[model samples]
Target: MDTHITGRTAADIADSVRSLLERGVLEPGDALPPVRTLADRLGVNRNTAVAAYRQLTQAGIAVSRGRAGTRIVDRAPVPQEGFAAGSVLRDVGTGNPDAALIPDPSRALADVVGRPVLYGEPVIDRELEQWALEWLGADLAPRDIRVTVTSGAVDAVERLLAQALTRDDAVALENPCFLSAIHTVRLGGYRAVPVPVDEQGMTPAGLRAALDDGVRAVVCTPRAQNPTGASLTAERAAELRAVLADHPYVLVIEDDHFSMLSHAPAQSLIGAHHRRWALVRSVSKFLGPDMCLAVTATDPYTADRLAMRLSPGTTWVSHLLQRLAFSLITDPEVREGITRAGAHYAERNDSFAARLRAYGLPCTPGDGLNVWLALPAPARAVAEQLMRRGWLPRTGEEFAVDGLPGSAHLRLTVHELDDTDAERLAADIAEAVRAVSRSGSGMIDR
Candidate 1:
């Protein structure tokens, strides 16, 4: 059946499709008529229909499959990491740091109290700003960098993108991108150009292709990339820097979200000669998610634009939150706790991967809070079986982009699991993989 969208302009046509989607008339995977066909039916220029489809694609509501027509998006390109609602199964997909591992902010609360921050004051806490400048500056190549504070990594990313790009501007993102970055690019009406990532982080060939495609900005996770836990090697970082040198004006944003907690050293993307770049670090993984604080160090031009939105008395992050994070990060005891927590996460994930390998499912333990387990069967099938066995696992499909095939990998978090729990879960996962292999397509209910 042909999808009927009654409108001429791009906005009108996009709105019609959006309404049909909301009403469930345009179901996921349902194909739209060819652009030319739609233009003829609507008695408008073919370019108008094309423009409308482009809008839908940018908004992450529809996808163009080249020879195949455009279709409504089945679900978000990247799903959030956490327990699914109404699920009673033990969750191994929530990308959460162990609560016990997070340093208690209450102990730091007393230290955070001081003079109340008045109106028109500097947006960032002075002490925090100075600390961040020193911390971020030490790693960056010689450059005139300025610092800006935002609510968290997500906030920093959103502000950076807004400052650097406009509607439909192409931005290169890692293929298995972070969910928030996917959401930010989609909601901002910007085009996301996917660059493939591997064990060594963003590949040189993929990044070169994206640069050739005229992407205005690039968002990279330098270490402990979400879902995949890939980190850039020194060699790969050099290659990427070389490729980016020709495109000096392109804004490169590195999200070092796992900084203190990451076992990997920072392999930076911003070379000394690159014209525009930002490095954002957040305390969410170490201090606590509730801390809601991140510091962004960037080139002066980007900082000026970011400051427009972060001006005092308007969108500035609360100094109280900033102080709390600063205190937690600086306390010697809290620092030790964070260091131990980091080691604990790495060890737990490594142990889980080793167990899975011994069970005949070879997997790698990456630096992030989770382990990516590769199964012999499709991850969704294995995940469904795991759910039946009272474990909820997140399939890699949620993190893939660009019409890429669903991965046989599962992103699992085991930082909070005990020895017994880890062993049991590994055994169940192996069984689930075997079951899926035996049953094939019949095992999973659509």
Candidate 2:
């Protein structure tokens, strides 16, 4: 293992460490030299070494031990699934929307370019705000709701948490949560209190327990929750609202990431009378990830604080991108395309899940772009077997927030696959499960 660390600047040193990590040159539990020793070796001031260490800690790449020194964290880094470069295996693990379903922005771009915004201009595009409010208002009960635009859902969540909660404050997050949300909570230094989510979304008992634990904020996905593709039923949403009623002051954040694509209706957890709340609708699913625009409907107080952080000339989302998103959403042809795309995703996911069940592996197709397939064997073993069979799938452990061994499950994005590919994946999945079910390693009953 390469354990050497050398750089004149803090950022340089941090980048070097991250590169080594990505290349697997330095594994977890490896120790770095003392700051004084590293500073001398790198020919930099002692403060530079300290800053580099601090940067690494903030990024969750390394942990500091009081008298012992700094070392790579023993835990596996959060899993991020990117395109499998140079791999001939059929990839079913990429957590992404179907590329063909995304509406082309070329037509919308013509209408998006008229205005050039200047400093001190309105942070949000006027037309976009009006349209967003109209769409959100139909679902939300009458109230004084404020709106803020952010680059993306993760960006909005990070800013919202920073504005409302202090470091180490407890924030309730769904168990087997969205990967980005998990990263946001961890990187923000907020304590994550896991609330179990079933088919109907976050369980009432789980929310009650988290509230009892004194979580200052609650993050929920009202529809098409990532990984599991779970949506909140109206009854379950009401139950959660009742639980949250006593604690109205807690900041409730609802990430409706699949707003346009969800086959389900919006079952909100933020009651009309809730004090501080935000409902984020990211357009990435419909428009494309490159759009990077999300409209946030928030309570006045939270919006005000978020505005403080996103002040003009600093953190405001670009108006050009906002207008481009708005143009696409308002276009009739694009709306029709989005509607067709939603149905296509639902059909594909359901079809894939049905095939899995037919093969004797239990699986359910939920509201999102992915299907959650519960396996009889450990997800790791099954995934390994599938990889050997020329497929890549994500294990449920990647989405677990509690750091415990996860239930046996695989989160697969098979909605983009054709009938033959989907069937092949299902048959392979069943075979993999049977091959590993008796191995007796990391098996957890759902």
Candidate 3:
């Protein structure tokens, strides 16, 4: 298939082919037609075709033989590790929510102890599942919602997609996707189609294109979109709903991973249509990630499919854990703690963004438990430099879909920084960005 690169560069044309192969559109050992035929088919010059082929060959994706024609070299290159071992920079790049902010599971778990469901017991805890449905249904309102709890939201999404898709089936996802989404798609052996996002969230054009390309599932972040805090606006969510109406049967999974941590009003893409869908709001961010629980709401049909996967041999989610989550959510003290944490994250991140701007680094701030900032150069070099300064920050590269590379950005857990620590760390990051840009070097300034 000729990748449509009508308005794209010659190299972009090549990249499209690479992207296609990465998505399994081009199978291993599959023969590509002669360069001339490809150029004619794609409306590109023969020289452009030659360059594109050479580019693919150098990427270890395709190989050339005198008369055998170019063939796909099966297999993917190992991904380079982006984060330094135990090098989480103190100032920024800690993807975790503030430890102090997590509702003390101690107090919440104090009340929970239930009789374990023994052999021959139903796989799901009926009361817990019913309560979970009520809690998860809080935002989206009544639909064909059914509750299916798994180890966590990641586990939930993985099982949900597996029940619906096959290996190499196209799964639409936001570009610069959540880390768990990337891992889930990879583990399931599914192809990810990148849908571009902006301040208002997933672009309509990108989504329409993905649908046209025959995607089987979509994984979207409604609010507190990781890496960038951009969320779906009310207008934008309505637009997506309108756009998705025609394709209701496509499984749409929305991950509200940072639920209740931001003051921003929730807007949903899944709310638009009544088709195969699941909206997962995990307690990881607002509640502690260690809770190991996620509230998943899916259509009745999809829930039935997931129930089979949750049956015996799985043993189901622990009754104790579910009761703990239920107790915590319903607790007045815990709810107050959540509100306090949301305010703390908002204020601290805003302050950090202010400091960055003071140093001439601009950023688009939004509602997340953390802040996203653009580095003067690629984020990796800046991150390495920070490590030498005794700080660890997460770069944008780690959060993108396989064929798409995230840009010069960093995600910082500003809420964890004290006032003095915040100022010093900001200065250190600024200096590091400048140093890497000047030397074009990977070594951090000692």
Candidate 4:
């Protein structure tokens, strides 16, 4: 392992350490040499070794003991799936929408121009905004509709929080919340109040609790919430609205990421009543992946405040891509494509969940792009076993909110599993639970 520690910089040192652990040269609890001695031996500054140590710590490949040196930590294995295109049965994780939902853009971009716009180019194309306005609907008018585009729903969330919050401010969010929303709040240096979300969107009790806590802002997903896919019901929405009515001026941000492709209609926290709110809807779901554009409708006053952070010199969204999105959404053929894709995703996910139930593995299959599964053991260990069987499953740990205990469940994207493979995965998951379900592993507490 020392033979590979030849470079004189921080990254080189980190790579050498990583390579050692990867090759099993340093097993768990084996201490690295003293920083000064390692620095001298590698012929580099002490800072380089320090930086390398930090990198390993972040990656969970190693841990430090202050004055003591570093040692390796156990890591779960990573699986390798083949890189094949045009297969809908291989995509997993929170961030991906169903591939079938993506608009076929080969024809749209085929004839489109390729010039990247220069400075002073319009931040938003006038024609595109007009089309987007119609797309969002006419009921959202009379109050104010300000359309601002961003990379995606997550991008819009970050910018909205940045403008509304100072570091360490409190923000309300859904519990077992979408990971991007949780991460965005934490990254902005804000404390998160996890309001519970049930069949009814944010519960009335949860809303009241959060408001009583004096949160600076609220991030909500009123429709087709990512992990659970439970769209807020009308009765629940009304109760939540009543709870929020007292704090009319708090910045209310709603992320309805499944804009056009959702099987159900959109619900809103920023609907007709609110005075200070933003309804952020992104096109990444129906449009092709990597297409980054979002339409934000806000109350006029809030729109002006948000605009201050979105002026020409700073963070305005792109214009050319906006036009391309406009061209696709307005076209009739692309609209049908989205409808077809939504049905396909629902059918596939429902089938997988039904099969899981048939196999005695209880789970929930709801409206979004994925399935939520409740396992009999810790999700992390089960996911590791799934990988060894050629399935790459994501655990719910990353998306758990502050108040919630880490789950024994996993959020599986059934889009990646075909009929045959779904059956096999279900069987493998059952075996994995039996193999790793050690009673005192702290899995229950986790």
> Regarding TM-score, does 1 or 2 come out ahead?
1
TM-score (C-alpha) between model 1 and the true structure: 0.87
Question: Which digits, one per residue and each the tens of the lDDT, describe model 4 over residues 353-384?
Answer: 88888878886677777787877778888877
**How would you encode candidate 1's per-residue C-alpha lDDT over 325-359 as one tens digit per residue?**
88878889988888898899899999998999889
At residue 274, give the lDDT of candidate 3: 58
The CA lDDT of each predicted structure is: 0.86, 0.86, 0.78, 0.73
| lDDT (Cα) of model 3 | 0.78
Estimate TM-scores for all models. 0.87, 0.84, 0.78, 0.75
As for model 2, its CA RMSD to the true structure in angstroms is 6.1
C-alpha lDDT (0 to 100) for residue 328 of candidate 2: 87
Local error of candidate 1 at 20, Å?
9.4
Model 1 bad stretches (over 4 Å): 1-78, 312-314, 403-405, 440-446
Quality of model 1 by C-alpha lDDT: 0.86
* Clash pairs (backbone) in predicted model 4: none
Clashing pairs in 2: none
Query: Where in model 2 is the C-alpha error above 4 Å?
Result: 1-76, 438-446
Better of 1 and 4 by lDDT: 1
Give the Å error, residue 39, model 2: 26
